[model samples]
Each structure stands twice: as structure tokens, then as C-alpha cells.
Target: MEEIEETPEEHLAKQHRKEKKDMQAKIQSMKNAIPKNDKKRRKQMTEEIAKIEADLNNKHEEELSQLKSSTDTKVEEVLNGVETMKMEGGKEAEAEAAEEEEEEEEEEEATQPRVTKAQKRRDKKATQEKERESRIAEAEVLNLQGVRHQEGLKLAQKLATKQLQIKEISSDGHCMYRAIEDQLAQRTKPEITMSMKELRSRTAEFMRGHADDFLPFLTNSNTGDMYTTDEFEKYCSDVEHTAAWGGQLELRALTQVLLLPMEVIQADSPPIKIGEEFDSEPVTLIYMRHAYGLGEHYNSVEQLKDPANAEDS
Candidate 1:
């Protein structure tokens, strides 16, 4: 029995059919053996089948290329049918391919040598960098909180200083202010209080220059007929009603007596004798008496009796 010569088209078709059948069988076998979680093994098997199919197709292409043109339509039909099948099964194929690739990669990695100390060092540095960044972020948050706390402290100090100023200006004694300062110290120390000593020295200097004005309010025993600053304030405002005279105290006459110009005084006018002026002058010179003694007060008015009195007044 002699071997019969098959046409090129028939040969190519036969080879294509054989490969397609083999691919289907391999696919079925893989589907049956594969576990849902054994994706790695499944991928490897699918890849092997695909390689085989590729080789078969390459062979068919070579054979078809050498054949006459008459079988073009038949070859195209078969190729188109294969393409359609691939399109329909593309998602499944991709999934299987990915799983297989992962399995192969993992196997390869397993076989590879362990990482060196240098590689571990690099990984450690990367981890350390990440940890450092996390710490820096945490530090930034803490710093923001600290800033807010500092700002609050500053505001509190400012308020405390203002309160202290008011207290110093209004308090009756130094002991009272000291008590208040000590109480404030038990809580957070106020920044403004730190400068209180300087503030006090400045206030004392100012008070010294204006001591005469304030002396009237001092201890009556030492002052001897002088009014205190508080008394003076009340007297000036006309709030003090305990005086000998009643009704609105006319101070304009006293101001005129004190401010009278030396040149303006008519020399011919009756000389304002000491007892005569006090007896006749309607205005009460309380501040003058409060500032100077009764005798000095009389001398002041007597000096002012003439134009030379301007210098004395």
C-alpha cells in the first residue's frame, strides 16, 4: 500500500484541527485538576498549553504559506473561527495567564538566593524614613498645640498686667497689691507681673514729682492740716460736704486771687491786708490752706496784696 499524497490545503486543515482538539483537551484537564486557590499551578498549565498551540499555529502558517492560492478562503475561515474563539475566551485566558505567571514567578523567587545584608539595610532605611516622617508629623501637631498654649499664656499675662495696673492705681495699700500678686502666682505666672517692679519704680518717680498733690491724702497726723489726694479730688469735684460752708463752693474768686497779674493790680487800690483780705475775699482758698499751713496761707495772701505779690503768689 503506497502512501497517498494529500493536498497542501488538506494537510494544513488536518494539522489545525489536531492542534485545536489538543488545546480543548488540555483546557478541560486543567479545569478539572485546578483548585480555586491553586491559581499558580493553573496558570502554569494554561501557559504550557498556549505555547503548544502557538507552535502548532506557526507550523500551519509555514505550511499554508508554501501552498497554492486556491485555499485562501478556507484558511481565512479557519483563522477567523480561531480568532472568534480567542475573543470569547479572552477574559478566562487572561485570568489563567496571570495566575500561572504569578505561580512561575513565585517558584523562581523561591529558588533564588536569600537577600544580602546590604539589601536588608536598604529596606530598613526605607522603613526608618517612613517612621521618621510619621514622628515629624506627630511633632508638628504637638508644636501647633504648644504654639496655641503659648499664645493663650501671653493673652492671660496681658490681662493680668492690666488688672494689676488698675489695682495699683485704686488699692488703698501696698499690702493689698502684694496679696493679689501672690494669689495670681499660685496659678500660671503672668508675664506682665515680671515687669511690675519697673512699673512700680516709674510710678513712684511720677508720684514724687506730684507728691504735693498726693500728700494731702497722706496720714493726717504727719500732714498737719493738709488734705489727702483723695480729699483733694473730692474737694475739687465739690463732693466733700462736711466743710463749714454749704451750697456750691465758689472757687473762681480764689483762682483770680492766685492768678492776678502783678502789672494788672491798681497800686492805688486799698492794699489787701492779710486779715482784711481773708475777711473780705469771698472765695475759699481751700487748696492753698490744704497745701500750706494757716500762717503760710495768710502770708501768701499778704504777699499777693501788692504787684510784688505776683512773684509770691
Candidate 2:
């Protein structure tokens, strides 16, 4: 007002009191809003009020000391008591508001879905099963590829054999083989008798020479070969020869023999001598040749089979 202005101290005191009143009202509102079930919220509210009161009391220390130092003990006591009461009021309000907030949170939690222990376990098992299945399928695919490759080898052999022709006698070189005309040899006399013992002996000698390829066909009990029955079947499986190149199994066998590790075969194999003879009959010869090895493919199969000459073989 133009008539009079309040002193600085008075203006400050008035502002402080108004601020104190607002704080008290806020605390009271907080208390009223506090729910009955929230003790934690109540405690927090009380702590907050205490903090505010401590701040206010620290700021008003000068006025409080002056009043106490003056000759007014009774007045100081009364004023201090009143200040304590105001601080308590603010604290009570805050406590109530915190309690209400805590209660609302509890209610929300109660409304959410709950999972049982059994359901959680079942879900975990299902996930594990799916992972296991994926692993099994991957393993199966690898196994299938191996089987397919073996089948392809067998098919190639069967095709080559069917289409193979016996060419006329060429130079007796071990590496040379050719396709020749399919001419039937004159039928042998029925009276001509061949010794089974001789054929067996010859076949056994021949097999010993070229043991690498034949070993896979024979059962392990017969000769310590490692191929399983299924593996053997896959290797020996028949194939339909196509007309493109006139497939013959003999050609396939010859190719395989060429690639065989010399160390695993007889060393002294006689040079392949397919004389002009039977074109219709398939002659399965087992040459007495040395196994091709790091240094020797000229040793005889009989020499290799001998235990005494094992080292040299």
C-alpha cells in the first residue's frame, strides 16, 4: 500500500509462514490419500516430513535464538512446542500419501497372471526336445550323403561292366585295357572237365594279389575286412547301364584297380594278358602281383602271405 510498507524482516517472516502453511497442507493431503495396507509408504512419508522440518528449523535458527536469548523463556517454550506440532502434522500427511501409493501397487500385482511351477517345467522340456530333434536331423543328412556316394560308386561299376567289350590281344602292358567286339567263343565240349581244386587255388592266389578291392566284398570273418554287411551291399549294388557309353562293370573294376593303393595289393602281378579268346565269358583273374607300396609293387602275393617274408613283402 502507498500508505505504508512492511519491513524486510516482517516481509520475510510472512513469506516463511505462508510457505510453512503450504507444506503442512501438502503433507496432510499425502496422509489422507495413503491406503490402510501400506506401512512402507507411511514410513517414507514420515521421513520426508522430518527432512523438510529440519530444513525449515535450520533456516529460522537466528530468529529462534534471539527469541530464546531474550527475557521470554515461556514464550520461547510455547513457540518451540508449536513448531514441533506443525512439523508432526506435515509428516503425518506424507505418511498417509505413501501408504495409499503402496496399496495401489499391491492391487495391480494381485491382478497379474501367475505361472505354476509345473507349467514352467513343461515349457523348458519342450524347448529341449526341439533342439534335440534339430541335431538328429542334421546327423541323418550327413549319413544319407555317405550312403548316396557309395551307391554312386556301385552304379558306375555296374554300368561299366555291362557295356565293357573284350578287345583283341594288345601289348601285354599292365595299364592297357580296351573295348573290343562282342564275339562268342566256340562252346567247349561238355566232356571237358575242369578241376574245381585248381580253379579255387588260382582264384585264391589272384584274390591275395588284388586283396584291396576284393577284401571289401568278403565278410570280415572270411578275411579281416572292415566293411559292414550294409556297406558291402551298397558297394555291390546293381545298376542299369545306359547306352551313352555302353556301361560295363569290368571297366569300373579296372578303374578302381588302377586307383588301388599298391601297398595293399600283390607286387608281382603278371602283366595283364587278355589274349584273343572268350568274349562272352567274363574272366575274373587274380594275378599273383606284389602290392603297390612306397617302394614295391612287384612282390608276389604268395611271398607277401608268407609269415617269414612278412617284412620284405
Candidate 3:
């Protein structure tokens, strides 16, 4: 028995199907490469893939329709030369085909996913809010852990009161500056709030002017050598303008800027003091702890009223 040869139309359809499948697979691979937590990138890739898929579908449909129309025209011409009855039958077949095509187009339109720009914006906002909430919850958990550890400290210089409130600061690389700003605002008259930018500028200037004091401690952790002059200049510039993560070095500069000792209280440890002692009455207390693997964070600590004082009130 001889195998039947494939028609030109069948071959064309098979080629289009393979092209469509390959394109779909490529799109899927691109989607898979995007990180799940990166909603913005995921949304962008999704939109791009949707456009590509739409274009492919439209081009495939147009090509197939043109091929079918050419075939129909050839059939009509053959029928006209053969018989009027066959020609009339061909017209009925064409009408049925048109109806079926219309139904298929309507089904495609109904099944196509529809998402408006407004809807997309809302979804993006919701995703951002969810991520923000998750971060806040994680920070709160870390804060509680730090508080528990602080409570268990065996130091004689413990917090005046057993009860303390912790105020979390934003950990956007400027946590140290923001934390210092919060402590200053609470400890000063008229409640001064220093912007992170201003704090950065002041800290940079102080470090640059008093390089002798800070340069010794500014050695590269990897190299274990003192920072070169160029490196120190770059460090000063980063402290001044960039959102560089602040550490003990910047904290020392901050002490000089504020002209007061910046005492850091940690869980189960003596207060790590910075800068020269001042005769000031109020001392800024910062709760220091590692937060969610994001380096060390400083949260302002507000001492609760003494039980005796509360009873008198």
C-alpha cells in the first residue's frame, strides 16, 4: 500500500502550528527567568509576551485565512467549468465556512484576557503594599527579639525602667541617619527633626575635617590596610551624597556633628559610647540589633514611666 502525500494546505498548517508552539515555548522561558518576588519586572515581561503572542496569533490567522480563500477561489473556478449544481453547492459551503469562522473569532475575542491599564496599576499598588507589610512584620519580629534580649541583660547600667517602647526606623541604607534623627528629635527642645540628607552632609564634613581621628579606623576589612587617600575621599563623597550604609564610622562622625556622645545600647552588653562626654542632661538611647539580615538597625528607645511616678499621677 502507498502512503498518501500531504496537501499543500496541510503542510502550511503544520508549519504554522510548529512556529506557534516554538513562540509559546520561548515566551514561557522568558517568563520563567523573571524572579517571582520582582513584580514590576514580571508585569513588564507579561505585557511584552502578551503583545508578542497577540501579534503571532493575528499573523497566523491572517495567513491561514488567505490560504483558505485562495483554495476556495480555485475550487469555485473548477466547479464553474464542471457544473452549475456543484457551483451552487460550493456557495453553500463557503457560507457555512464564513459562519464557522465568525463563531471562532467571537470565541477567541471572548476568551482573550482583558486587563485595563487602571486594573494593572491597582494590582501593582496592591503588590507593593503587600511587600511593604511583609517587611514591616519581619522588622517588628526582630524588634521584639531584641527587646526580649535587652530585658534579659545582667548589666547594672540597664534602662531606668523595665518597660520600654521601640520605634522602628526605615532601613533603606539610611537607617543609621534616620535613627539618629529620631533620637535627636525626642531628646531636644522643640523636637528637632534632621533630614537624612542634612545628616549625611554634616557627617561627611566632620569626618573629612577630622580625618586623623577617623582614618585609623577606616581600614578596608578585606585588605586590613588603612584606606588610601583616594579611597578616603571617595568614602567622604559617598557619605555626603550617596545612600551608603552607615556603620560605626559614620556613627562617630555623627557624634562630632551633634557635639554629644552617641551611646548605642545593645542586648546584654554595655553601652557602646562614641564621641566625647558632654554635660547634657538628656542622653539619646538607641536600641541596636541586626534586622532580617539587613545589617544592624537602630530603633529609638522610649523609657516607660516609673511605677511609683505612675501611682502618684
Candidate 4:
């Protein structure tokens, strides 16, 4: 069968419909997978599915609106091209082709059933990019300032020369581990990358086995005494099983666990290099004291595509 060539607008619109259908079908499948006797689970899933559907509808409407705008723009462009064709000795083929495409677009708009696999990948990437931008904008709205803000600016200036930007990690007491995880995911291959739980576990295990290295520094604030064996055990348990805020000791342990050097960049201080004995390239993380109103937070650094145009600079 001969493949039909669609105008850009028609092509994009068709892709939009397929994405919507795929999402709806996925939700339906999820709904079906929930057992009928599981009333509580069914209710939760139904609510979540409804919310997803609402969001999807809004997104689809916005895209369709954009397509409508693009359609108007394309019509204007085609008219301009047709006028040019008339001026250039009346090129009948070019004008007729444009006319047919416009007619075909109208006829086929409601019948678009499928989109290519490559288009799905492109759509997914576009969605992720938009989500990233949305996160950045949200952080901007709740701006940080004063000491932390100044430090962030200084760090930004430093990173500008290196074509890097701070990718903010969530401030849920696990920022340090999360920042390291993010850096590892980007810097290392999949097999070498560690998840939050794995990183936490390794940090705890390393600290537990090498108590003398870390225990000396962990004095009780109330008693002014070194941690007892049980106290230390509890601390390590929290480090591994709970969202205990990761600190210098965890960073030190992670360097050994992953067998990679860790570089910590900070404002008002020099870069702190851990695991210097290792020969591998360091996974870098930035320490933010007050950015995003999250005190003592950690963020990862990523290189910008347009390195020449650093926005924070």
C-alpha cells in the first residue's frame, strides 16, 4: 500500500490522538486489573484515573488549540507561496499540490487512527521537557534569597564557565542521596548506577563496618559522649531504612561503595573532593544551604545543550 504524506499540522494532530487513545486504554486496563471485590483499591484507582483523564483532556485541548493556530499560520503561508508561484510564471504543480494538501487535511482530520513509533518517542521526550520546564518555573515562583541565594548565584557563575546548571533535587531530607543518585544516573552506565535505597544501604553498611572512621565524629549533643554500640546501630539502621538526612559520612561511604570520586561544590567554600584515591571521574553534586527554602539541600549539575548561552550567567 502507498503511504499517505500528511502536512505537518495533520501529522502532529494525528500523533496527539494516538497518544490520547493510548493513555485512555492504559487507564482502562489498570481499572480492569483491579479486582471488583477490592472496593477500597477500586475507589482509589478510579479517582486517580479520573484525575489523569482530566489532565489529559486539558493537555489535548491545549495542543489542539495550538494546531488550530498553526493551521491558520499555514494557510497564510500557503497563500503567500501561491502568490509567489503566480509571479514566477504561474507554477501550476506547486499551487495545485498545496491546494490538495489543504483539502486532504480537512478530509483526513477525523480519520487519523495511528502514529509512527518514532513519533511516540518524540512525543514522550517533548512531554518530559515540558515537565522539566514546569518544575524550573515552579522553583522560580517560590524564589530563594539572602545567604543561600547569593551562594547559588556564586555557584551559578562558577558553573557558567563549565556549561553546567543546577538541577534541583527535592528537599525531602534525602536530597544528598537523591543528588548523588541523579549524578550517577547521568555520569555512569545503568549497571553502575545506584538507587536511593541501595545508596543508603551501602552508606550504612560501610559506616557500620568502619565504625572508627565515623563514630569518633558522632558525639551525642545531649550527653557530650561518643555514641555507644547500640546507639550507633540504631543510627545506622535509620540511615539504611529511613529518610535520615545524608551527610558527610554518607558521602564518604558512597565514594567507596560506588568506587567513584565525589566532588561537592559549595558557595563560600572550595570544592570538597572525597575519594581522591580513586582514579575515576568524580560524580559532582552542589550543596545549597537555602535554595528553594530547603536548608542544607543538595542539587546535581547537568551540562546545557546551548552551552554558549548560560542563562544564570
User: lDDT of all predictions, in order shown?
Assistant: 0.41, 0.41, 0.68, 0.78
TM-scores, all models, native as reference: 0.19, 0.20, 0.47, 0.53
Tens-place lDDT digits, model 2, residues 88-200: 87977768888999999999889966778997777777766765586568656765656333433343333233332122222112111211211112113221222323222
Report the Cα lDDT for residue 242, model 2.
Answer: 12
lDDT for 281 (candidate 2): 32
Q: Which candidate, 2 or 3, would have the higher lDDT against the true structure?
A: 3
Candidate 4 lDDT over residue span 21-123, tens digit each: 7676567545534434335767888898889889988897888888899889989999998788778856787679789999999889868767889987887
- Stretches off by above 4 angstroms in model 2 are 62-313
lDDT tens digits by residue: candidate 1, 1-313 = 1224557766577557756775675455444433333346657767876887788778877877767565777789899997997898888996898899999999999998888899778877776676558656865676565633343334333323323111111111122123223333433433224122332333344344455644545333333567656654444333122211211112222122233111111112322222233322221111111111111111111111233333332
Q: In angstroms, give how far residue 209 of model 4 lies from its true place.
A: 1.0
Clashing pairs in 4: none
Best by lDDT: 4
lDDT for predicted candidate 1 compared with the true structure: 0.41
Candidate 2, RMSD to the unseen true structure: 38.5
Candidate 1 stretches with Cα past 4 Å from truth are 1-6, 68-313
Residue 110 CA displacement from its true place in model 3, Å? 35
Q: After superposition, how far is residue 259 of candidate 1 from its true place, in Å?
A: 99
Give candidate 3's total backbone clashes. Answer: 0
lDDT for each residue of candidate 3 in 1-313, tens digit (9 for 90 to 100)? 1233557697787668767776875665454344343357668888988898899889988988998999999999987876875576797787888899999999999998788999778877776676558656865676665743445342213443445545667655566787777777777473345777999999899888998988888766456789888878888998788767677788877766676777776665677877757545333555454342313456666655565553343
